[model samples]
Target: MYWFLLLMAGVFESAFAIGLKLSDGFSKPVPSLLTAIAIALSMLMMSLAMRGIPVATAYAVWVGIGVAGSLTLSYLFLKEPINSMQLISVALILFGVLGLKVTSTG
Candidate 1:
C-alpha cells in the first residue's frame, strides 16, 4: 500500500510538472490551481509512504519516477527530442529504483 502511494505521489509530481509547463509561469489560473493541488497531494502521499518505506529509498524512488515520467511525457506531448543517451539514463534510473525496492525491508 505504501509503495502504491509512493508511486501515486510520483505520478502526481509528473502531473504538476506538466501543469506548470502548461500554466505559462502560473499566468493561467486553472492550470496553476491544478498544479498547486497536485503538488499538495503528491507531498501528502509521499509523507504517508515514508511511514513504511525508508526515507532514503522512498525519496530516491519518488524522484526517479517523477523524472522518468516527466521526461517521457515531455517527449510524447511536447514533441521534445529524445536521444539514445537520454533513454539509457532513464533506464538506469529505473534500474536503481527497482534495486531499492527489492532491497527495501518494507
Candidate 2:
C-alpha cells in the first residue's frame, strides 16, 4: 500500500511539473489551479507513504520517479529533445530505484 501510494505521489509530481509549464508562470488560471491541487495531493501521498517506508528510501524513489516521469512527459507531449545520454541517465535512476525497493525491508 505504501509503495503504491509512493508511486502515485511520484506520478502526481510529474503532473504538477507539467501543469506548471502549461500554467505559464501561473498566468493561466485552470492549469495553475490544477497544478496547485496536484502539488497538494503529491505531498499528501508522500507523507502517508513515509509512515511505513524509510524516509531516505522513500524520498529517493519519489525523486527518481518524478525525474523519469517528467522527462518522459516532456519528450512526449512537449516535444522536448531527448538525447542518448539523458536516456541512459533515466535508466540508471530507474535501476537505482529498483535496487532500493528490493533491498528495503519495509
Report backbone clashes per prediction.
0, 0
RMSD to native, candidate 2: 0.6
Could you tell me the TM-score of candidate 1? 0.97
Write down the lDDT that model 1 would get: 0.96
lDDT of 1 by residue, 1-106 (tens): 9999999999999989998998999999999999999999999999999999999999999999999999999898888899999999999999999999999998
| Superposed model 1: Cα runs more than 4 Å off | none
TM-score of model 2 vs. true structure: 0.98
Instruction: Report residue 42 deviation for candidate 1 (angstroms).
Output: 0.5
